[model samples]
Target: MRNLLPLRSALAPTTTVAAFAATAAVTAGFVTAFAAPVAVTAAPAVKLVAADAETNVAAVATDGTTIRYEGLSVRIPAAGEGVQAAAQSTSGDLSITVSRSADGSVVVKTDKHEHSVAQAASASTSRANSAKTCTDSAYQLAGWKLPSFTWYYNPAGTPAALSGTASSAITTATNALSTACGQRALGLATTNGGQTTAVPQVGTTGNCIGNDGRNVIGWVAGNGKWLGMTCTYYKTVNGNKTVTGTDTALNTQYKFFTSTANCSGAYDLQSVVLHERGHSLGLNHVDQTAHASAVMTPALSACSVGKRTLGLGDFQGLVAMYGTK
Candidate 1:
């Protein structure tokens, strides 16, 4: 069933954050796709931390359950059920489905025919996967540095049914992402320093410079920001709000979930968003390898659950942008 989010804060805490309003950055001088320096780093690895049953974080992975998401309405009628997803990362094969009950309630699902952690290895093998090396300055962002999968929304992976356990799974996955992203934010703050005063953007919503104390999240976010953005899809709109600020989320009501079939925990929407938010904070993806896994790794896997919780590399990266504590 569809869970409507109540009008709330810039970032509201919900059982199903994806069912709640949720809300980033990109690579490039402005922000577009994920790119990396010509240099290289070692392979990538991850470490994990259990923040709570619902939340886990990886400093190297990004942040944590502080992440959030929203359920999207899909209209595809080909397979079993139409899926809900705003965007899909082209990183691999993905399908979406959703089924509506007579009650006008929505049940979503996805099927990632082919998407895996090993695939990430082959997909982004160069500086593209350079999130492994933080010491390399070539992997820096000017105003904002976009990552390889930093497209507005990459061709996402397979999706699962929205109803049944899918919703809970989706919600859990979202929370996990928030936790991971949150940790990375802290990592940035801790590495560079901690925030004490105002946000540095100078505007209600703007690009993130680095964690000064206050986050560079967004503002127009409320209720279900993602849901509200539905009116702008495929209309040359700005897509989802990509600004930076603290506690800001995407158009909750406006989310268009990617497929969910194999997505189960394979792909955490909230976690993915949380990772993106990290980039907005001026943190870039750490190359894979280095006997360390970064929150910025291009791909995420179940085995990476722990490492996804902010790690030292992630913290230091944030520090590099903001200041070291």
Candidate 2:
């Protein structure tokens, strides 16, 4: 069973801060499906401190908890969740979910079935045992949905040496979600708010929770094990959870390729953005072992451009949440 817990700002001494909303990041872990293999490493242990009373910083406990900074609230997974845990936190009507990926193996794709990177190692063995199918239709909701929101981009955070059309690629990736689910279902504005110098309120060391009352996407430079993280802020309205704000940060330590034709060992930018956008739009990671074809799966491969497109389960999940077109 999944757990939904409300977190209090460690900075608040007496009163619970309700004005700020929650944040989440969809950290990426990569694997390769081609020939040369990428080394898989474990994510570093998160260290937390109060810093100062005004910092709103808090530590993640053994059972997962909330961390806050002023009006910014974030939820980090416990010790055992690793990168696989899909954590969701609720504070009154506001809630957040952080979806992360784990170190993956090669995802196998055959005529009969496709295996997620997380399950690729065992796929061959399973295939030998019995015929596998790619018909797994499974997805989970984040308990919230955005009726409509216009997001902005921060080109200042773009990698200094990135090639290809980064901005256009990101815009296309963001729109891919609504395209998959149909506009009537997810109603995201076709136009963005343009680029801005303002950065996402997420940090490199701890939880990705921060609420600045804007939907922004940018990059963060760090050695964190995850590829990208999406922080979505939502509040309950009339008994329904509605998204109010969001911020997404892509780790600069890893190399990303916008054009698959130029892709070497780098991960696909559109694929990563597609996955994060799914989280931003209120979709959680389905069991990758069960739904490998899903864009909502927690694992991805280096050149899996196919992920740029949503699977049957991904479409169904969105329709289920926002309603059918």
Candidate 3:
């Protein structure tokens, strides 16, 4: 059965903006190639931690109910669905959501919100003292990791503007995530699995598909509502919930630039992709109000390229989760 959830109800409204600019959505998000699927173990009635701050929120909930965490919210899933979580980007701020599945698995989603240059500048000015003191050194733990996984690119629906450089930009984005821990923890192919018909499982309206046992990343029509979205799926293995699949979708609604020098009013593809990739790797959104420079922060500014590199908190959080290689 298709695990369905309406986007409008799932992603709650911020004070100033709605969750997504598009319509409703369906289920969840990643890697490896040509390997036989591993059987997943299931346990019942798992409760997730709910916190008001961004750094301590659990990425998935196996309790079979909807949940809200500060800036994040997730809806319950249809029966027979595996776990999934999502990270979403908006015109206002970034946030994350998680859902429970019938089989005791979980899902997570995350996004990066977009902001005007003026607003970005003002935020920086106000946080200047904080940034200097390393107050930006906060990161969220999504409770899962992809120690080794293979991801593929599906450029079939890539936007015309990003077509020329999307592949290389994605490569750089994923690489940044891999090396943040001081070693090549991600076992992705130096070159991706090449283009395929498989698009990311994330829906245009911010829903996701169940784990299909493939990790695909690509573009889709999102109509400027979001910059990028990531969905992560988890399964019980030896009483521990481990990530089984993840997928990322880049919205074609907004214009994106590959080069900082050439960026004008457009977003930076690598920066946005890097943030989304952080979600895929089990990093939740830090509070942008407090950690504006961190890649895991919930919002981003137009023409910003700093996110292409991990900030101090981003690095520490990654090390805390995956440990330094």
Q: Using TM-score as the measure, which candidate wins?
A: 3
Q: Per-residue lDDT for 131-195 in model 2, tens only?
A: 11223446666567777768888877577556348888888888777645223444445458998
Poorest 10 consecutive residues of model 1 by lDDT?
227-236
Best by lDDT: 3
TM-score of every candidate relative to the true structure: 0.29, 0.60, 0.65
On a 0 to 100 scale, what is the lDDT of residue 220 in model 3? 78
State residue 120's C-alpha deviation in candidate 2, in Å.
14
Tens-digit lDDT track of model 1 for 137-191? 2232212221211112211111223323333333343233222322433322212
- What overall lDDT goes with each candidate model? 0.28, 0.52, 0.58
| Model 3: number of backbone collisions | 29
Off by over 4 Å in 2: 1-136, 181-190
Residue 305, model 3, lDDT: 62
